[model samples]
Target: MVHVILTHEVKDFFAWKKVYEEGEPLRTKSGIKMTGVYTSVDNPNQVTLTGECASAELVYRFMSQPELKAAMQAAGVISAPDMKVLNKV
Candidate 1:
């Protein structure tokens, strides 16, 4: 399995959470299995989402969709996301 670490800004914790919850079905449909998620204690807007996937390519494909990008932008994630792909030790 491949692991993905996504760092992005969160406009509002509750609002972003709503978006995350709303996207749960899509995540599953795209072959993502969420391992965990984190938000900065000092700055709630900074979020890190960790998940396992069959392929990094697949994850990128799903997240790069126009609708997904638009939703993220609406949520106040202004900058391009930083994605870290990992492998199990």
Candidate 2:
């Protein structure tokens, strides 16, 4: 199993959440096993999303989409997200 960590900021939490929820199907079809999303304790606009996927390669496929990047930018994400890939020993 692989863990994918994504950290990003949005202009509005509720609006961003709507988009995320709407995109659930695409992710489900893409082989993400499970996912958990959390908001920063001190910053409402910031979010951390952790997903358990079949493999690091699958996770990379999801993150490497041009549409995803454009959506993030259009949603007012000010900076590039920080992505961390991890594995359990």
Candidate 3:
């Protein structure tokens, strides 16, 4: 399995969450098997998302899609995202 970790800052958490929910179909279609979300206790706008996928290549493709970038912009993401893909040992 492949694990994806993403961190970013959003202008509004609620708005970002709404946009995120709207992208469920795309995410599923991109081979996301499971996901978990977390927010920073010190800064609510800081968001972290972890996803499990069938392969790192699939997750990388998903992240590179133009639609995903548009979605993030529409979701009010105010900062560039940090992402990492890991393979299960």
The numbered model that scores best in TM-score is 3
lDDT of 1 by residue, 1-89 (tens): 89999988777777887778787777898899888879888988788899999988989898878877777866667557899989889
Listed per model in order, the count of residue pairs whose N, CA or C atoms clash below 3 Å is 0, 0, 0
Cα deviation of 10 in candidate 1 (Å)?
A: 1.8
Model 2 residue 12 distance off true place after TM-score fit, in angstroms: 0.6
TM-score between candidate 2 and the true structure: 0.87
**TM-score for all predictions?**
0.88, 0.87, 0.94
**Pairs clashing in candidate 1?**
none
Report lDDT per candidate. 0.83, 0.82, 0.91
Q: In angstroms, how far off is 38's CA in candidate 1?
A: 0.9
Every model: Cα RMSD to truth: 1.3, 1.5, 1.0
Where does candidate 3 clash, by residue pair? none
Q: How does residue 70 of candidate 1 score in lDDT?
A: 73
Q: Give candidate 2 regions above 4 Å deviation.
A: none
Q: Write the per-residue lDDT of candidate 2 for residues 4-67, one digit (tens) a residue.
A: 8889988888888887776777788888754788899999999888888888998899888787
- The best candidate by lDDT is 3
Model 3 regions more than 4 Å off: none
lDDT of predicted model 1: 0.83
Where model 1 places Cα greater than 4 Å from the true spot, the runs are: none
